[model samples]
Target: MSRVSLQNPIASLEQLAETPSRKDGISEQLEDDLRSFGCELIQSAGILLNLPQVAMATAQVLFQRFFYLASLKDFGIIEIGMGALFLSAKVEESFVRMTYLITVYDHLLRRIQQQSTHTPLDAFSQRAYSLKSMVTTSEMQILKRLGFNVHVQLPYGTMINYLRILGLEEHDTVPKKAWNYLNDALRTHVYTNYTMPTIACGAIWLACRDQQVKLPTTPGGEWWLLFDAQPSEFQNVAAHIQRLYHRKLDRQQLLSHLSDTEATLRNS
Candidate 1:
């Protein structure tokens, strides 16, 4: 029996710095870019597939966690991403058919390539059969590598509850803005490093700052303390989330780099 925990354990800065990819000589920039790419795939594909926010968030977290255990040289990002999305849908009880997943991913890849003449993956094609096998295998690999402890405690519900507690749930734009910030934060490493309360608090802080709305701050302590989040910690979380928007990934270059890496791996 797999022991399901309430949430995945958070890693320290040092542990995060020592990812398998880093140890494999992959540059920090490329690793970060890859993570962002994987998250984008999950988010865009989820939106196209009409998956709920929580389900998409779960897939991104799982995808991040899996790469921490397996290096980019060993596992293809698309395969692990597809597996993560497939497994996450099941985990969140928003079950989507495997065929739909395959089609969506194929469409996304073709769209990225801007190939107008591309055809949908035929169900009986060898490529489709191989991809399905890879997705299932990658799913099992992620489960085993993570010790069957794939539970992710997302900040969405916590953010909502915190907003209600802070009397900001009904405030104009605060709730929606905070929720949007939380969604964007999913693309960053903050999800793996910060606690749920801290993330929720950070999103709220960013939203408040954006809307120029004041949160209760007294000499006694900050309002976020009531939710067990420290001022410095949540502030840093907000900063990390903010920096995510400043990045611009070169998709063609990134794909070429990965291709070169795989060629080297195969030839070696």
Candidate 2:
């Protein structure tokens, strides 16, 4: 029996399309900051829980939707990030307690402070409060934004289903490697610009290639199945996702960007 449950997938693009962009200029900056924070938080939570790509993706979706309605200035980035993590765990059916979630935040804050040479508690407290308030308010907003669509089908679930359909159990190294690669892909912000179906198809294709899976065709043919399964409106989304993966985003580059951003945030 599969450990994960199959559920309804989130209609994220639909929700995002309906949400009117806030008029405040700062809202854009706040969204960017919150997105960065959400990425870090999701990375941390994935490590702590040993979560799969599907869970991380679900969390990302939840975080994005929450921020879509709630302003960063009102709730604070930290609290909203934590809350998103908390809510994502529930959505993914991997429920972690709020206390443990807070502890994780505390640990993460301390680590950030140690790296930046700043006081953790003082710097993070106000932001944390803001996160809390935003989460409290945005929780409702997220539900409404989603049209109470609580089901969130993850790529991990699809991977597992594929594995089962293939009848290749017994911890195959190739599939496991492919799964990890897909999980890493989920962490990137590129998915926001593409439809989930397209992203999933691309991630799965990349993972299979990384594992040297004997695909029907090199790339295009294998993706045909995904395209057929995807909604017609998002047909072109795969092209965009493919473009993102082809672009360079090495670890060293990401680390440099993170370091520079952290320094700026601390100095500010």
Candidate 3:
């Protein structure tokens, strides 16, 4: 429980469009790489620290949300992600000691330094920012950037509910695979732009359809129609996630989506 004065009250949807990350201080490609790297680091750190998947998933959303208001150029990936992971643990009621994340982060730095394809940035190793102080400070910045909106609705709950309704809650295997899909979704923009139920529905839908989990024959409607959400957004979520692993195929799928948008624009 922490209270900080709101930097600015959210007034309109347009305000959400004005993310600081779109400020062009960093190239889009570079920003994507850094953001992806930070997200991966959190996953690795979470595993190393024995933190649960929900903590890492929540941390990923906070990481993505914070960068929208702030800037990657202003904050190093290690600091932003570490702070997000720490704060998320608390927010999700899974308290993690700061020492664990900072320590795992240091280990991640060492691994990155050893990797031949990448080099650790100077800021990555700066002694000044490596300390715990940087994480606590970045936590405040995350709150400020988020306008103090820290209550995130994670897909875990909805995923469970959906799986239960489908009679696969305790059946294991596919549901677990779908759960992994939900965790992996944090790297995509769907979490920030779409509702949790939408993303959850997408994950389960993909697991059943693409991943070969059986569905009941009696249900005639589209699987996503079961949830009260924008099915288009769920499709968007599915596309982005499938793109992460099936880049070659989903890249074309992504282009097809863009191509459709262009065609609609032309008709307009």
Candidate 4:
């Protein structure tokens, strides 16, 4: 649920012995933090470029995969984050100019500095020239790590197709919500852990549950069995989406109550 479907998870000792360097990366917690931040940057770039979620999703996957092979110690996380956005635009065929991208990256870095003034870190991070140089290098490194494997599989498209099959293409209920859910999934390691098809099924199921749309397979055995999907895995996917919604609702409620209290004080 929290991961994208992994491919060939089982590793023979021979393979592990051959690739011992992979073990020399950052700590688990550090990797988690960096991956989360990288996704945030990708989301920011998407907003800045007015790109679609597809691009955002692609960029996030690139960021995740790049870090899987290359260590953050070797390359700046932000550089690869932006580079992923740059590379993903091409992969998704929604190319944004490098200058525009640099501008967005600089803006985000400046914001970080304003939030907490650091020393040379802020100085270097805010430079357009430095960003350009590092991102170009990071992009090459990412491509090399991926072995030029720029293609990414996402549940967004598969989910849409499935919704279309269900005749909910224009319903705005399941498909739309599912689309948002798919985007939300990228914020976590969901893409790295779950299979694309399972993610699609889970999103659709969660959307349907929210919309109160009746499922044909409900009140029965694994609803997705007909589609060759594991119901248990899909349940995990649903749970992830549900958690996102619960967290979102909690924030909204907190904000609403805070605003109401402020209003009361203003009137008093």
Candidate 5:
């Protein structure tokens, strides 16, 4: 795939930042909207493979950032999703081999029970080549649209670093359930629309609470008390993030919409 033009990545991001849409309070709801049009294609791919949550979250950020600047009409959402996943793998330092990704995709198809008569290896090779071509072309457009902002900071990284700094032992660290919820949080435009660092911290804290991690809390503020006695200081940011979670869109509802849209697309 060709790289995006070396002109300016910011210009494209500006365009994405300005697109108008109805506000759905839940992060998952917004994610469903994006997925309905194939925007979350990579995310689905990650889910099927049980790839690390960090990898999935990284892909989501890339998708949002790319869409912020580029139009979705010329390139289908599936292409963008593929490119986002490929790019994210590189960004997060996970670096799944092209062959491995292809294998995973093939495995996913079988797991989902999609009709495929080819051997897993054969199916993977064919699909990988196709996905690679699409991603190559889309990468060029994405880079041009993004003005070359390839450095995407992820919440997972931030959250882990914060936890370490707060002297939380790995055993007492953020629970898996909380981590999963935070992973979902990354799917929303919240990172782009709000203060991400603060929200990430808050999400970890909340996750810890949900799992009963026994972390201390501030008296009445939005910030939570960490083990080291320093507050994470997410008062304002936490409020917004909490509100979004409180108004979370139902997963089943989103799934129904996705199924309907996929059916329509296939019919078309």
Candidate 6:
């Protein structure tokens, strides 16, 4: 019920284009695709590493915030994502060992490449050492870029509290559906753009709409006014989550998209 003073970094699409992360050669579409891809990488790696959902969500927020401060062209998503997850472990107290983290990432990278190399990476090998260094360096870079302010305010708790206040907490399906929406919303940049309360309200709105569970909407102010959300913000959050389902991107898929764009540019 209390507002957290921490806020995530926010930037408009136009502002993002001007940031260091937007190099002259990279297309906005390519960057957007990669953002989604990076978040997916963090989420997948988190799950494989047996990290809690809160850690994964916090990592995604860190990954998203870093990209806003840096450029996709300048950094590899694999490294940054791993760094985010590693740092998030410390922040969230999930405490995954570096060796285990790198091993899972190695496995994930191979899977993404669809490679036949199933040989486990040796912890003493040069490659493992390189990966460890890469992740550590990225963690430092992220800390510096964000000025060591990595506090993230998640919307899950807020959503539940709002539902209870609205007398919808007892509904079996609404809470679960809304929670899923919040999870998917992390794949996009909605967290950076909207406050925690707004995101919570948006998820609730989507869930209620899907279930045909209407809330009180007095003329003086809509139901959302009880929270800190505007009706317009709900549409944007819903659209972001909807677009995530519509466009699925992985490392290889994003590379293909970039290749197609380059080819089209050559013909132009």
lDDT of 2 by residue, 139-247 (tens): 5656665566545545655555554543433346746764654555443444445544455455455555566765444254443363444534333433333443455
Descending-lDDT candidate ranking: 1, 6, 3, 4, 5, 2
Candidate 1 similarity to native, TM-score: 0.92
Q: Model 4: per-residue lDDT, tens digit, 131-172?
A: 676678778888898778677877766777777766778885
Best candidate, lDDT: 1
The superposed Cα distance between candidate 2 and the true structure at residue 119, in angstroms, equals 9.8
Question: Candidate 4: lDDT of 189?
Answer: 59
Candidate 4 displacement at residue 4 in angstroms? 20
User: Scored by Cα lDDT, where does model 1 land?
Assistant: 0.83
- Give candidates' CA RMSD values in order: 3.0, 7.6, 10.6, 10.9, 7.3, 5.8
Clashes of each: 0, 5, 0, 11, 9, 1
Query: Each model's TM-score?
Result: 0.92, 0.58, 0.76, 0.73, 0.59, 0.88
lDDT tens digits by residue: candidate 1, 199-248 = 99999999999999999875668787789989899999999888788888
Q: Clashing residue pairs, candidate 2?
A: 75-130, 75-131, 76-130, 79-131, 80-131
Clashing pairs in 1: none
lDDT of model 1 at residue 159? Answer: 88
Clash pairs, model 6 backbone: 21-71
Which wins on TM-score, candidate 5 or candidate 6?
Answer: 6
List the lowest-lDDT window of 10 residues for candidate 5: 20-29
lDDT by residue (tens digit), candidate 6, 2-103:
654567666677665565655546666667788788788888889888899999999999988888778776677788888999999999999999999989
Error of 4 at 124 (Å): 14
lDDT of 3 by residue, 167-252 (tens): 87886576877888887787766677777778888888777776577765336675556777566777788888887785322334
Cα lDDT, model 2, residue 171: 41
TM-score-superior candidate, 3 or 5: 3
